[model samples]
Target: MAVEMEEKPVIKLAAICGSLRKASYNRGLLRAAMKMCRDSVIEGIEMEDIDISELPMMNVDLESNGTFPLVVEEFRHKIRGCDAVFFASPEYNYSLTPLLKNAIDWASRPPNAWADKPAAIVSVEGSGKSGQYHLRQIGVFLDIHFINKPELFLNAFEPPKKFDDNGDLIDEETRKRLQDVLLALRAFTLRLMKGKSY
Candidate 1:
């Protein structure tokens, strides 16, 4: 009898935070998500943070001159290399933050690196319902396949129930939900890769 070996498929996921602040609640949510994926037994799924704060605002003239900044190139490269993406956005004035929109615009230029990639968004703020709605509407035009269920909205201002003094996610329920989101993202990415409808 021959021994059989099983191989696990590796899924690469890129994550970005909409807020540039070092102590941003949205960034903390992404950290929690990364931790959940790291501690999971889901096997072969890896997530990395892509810093978008360094990207400059979109300028058509610069692009037309073939002078896309190094940061923009790196951002696009990460998106192109990843199997999926996770966006942790913070709502500002009932819409997505400028940082997140700028990053998205850079990735959607010309070749459109975001097209056909599986993505999920988790909004962390006082009120995220509006931001999530706006992001979804924009996502439709970007052609990114987003997992619609298990939509995560964490109220950072809810106090002692969810975040700590340092703004890290500490609630057990919210942690479980973050894990669920990661698992769902992995499953959906695999389904899309196999040309199956999720």
Candidate 2:
């Protein structure tokens, strides 16, 4: 007699980078996480990035008609459909970048898409941990369920070797931490789906 093996559901995660620069280290870190997910390192998980650069600044004037821009709508749709979120923040002026804030503002409007979704944050910063802190504060208002352990606070400046010359994340230790964060996020999301609280 052959026993049937139960199949695990594929968890979809959406990643957002807080920087728009072409050579942003935060983006590189995000890419590394994505590559790991693509390689099936996380088991039954898929990850993709939703670009926030195209989102226009949050302006109430633009929403006078009670409609979000096409790009903003698309962003909200992606977040709403994903099982979890991953944010790679690059500290700017001791805080999250305006680009990322704008994207969040758009999504936090009516029918908040970020609500109840398990989230994780990683940052490539010099010394300021404010960016991650600010993200967590915002998560409170957005009702985002974030994994609080194993926070990835990588210092790209003082590191012996964080990224390669090509801006790819080459540090094995950091990569391992990122993988752990993703795994935690996967478990966290599954728990929430099963009506369990963190």
**Model 1 agreement with the true structure over 63-155: per-residue lDDT tens digits:** 855547888988899999999999998889999999899989989998899998899999888764999889888889999889988999987
Model 1 scores worst on lDDT over the 10 consecutive residues at 60-69
Report the Cα RMSD per candidate. 2.5, 2.2
**Model 2 score (lDDT):** 0.88
- Candidate 2 ranges beyond 4 A from true positions: 1-5, 196-198
TM-score for candidate 1: 0.91
lDDT of each: 0.85, 0.88
Q: C-alpha displacement of 181 in model 1, angstroms?
A: 0.8
Q: For residues 103-198, write the lDDT of model 2, one tens digit per residue.
A: 999999888999988999999888879889988999999999889998999888875788987779888988899999988998888878767433
Clashing pairs in 2: none
Say which candidate scores most in TM-score: 2
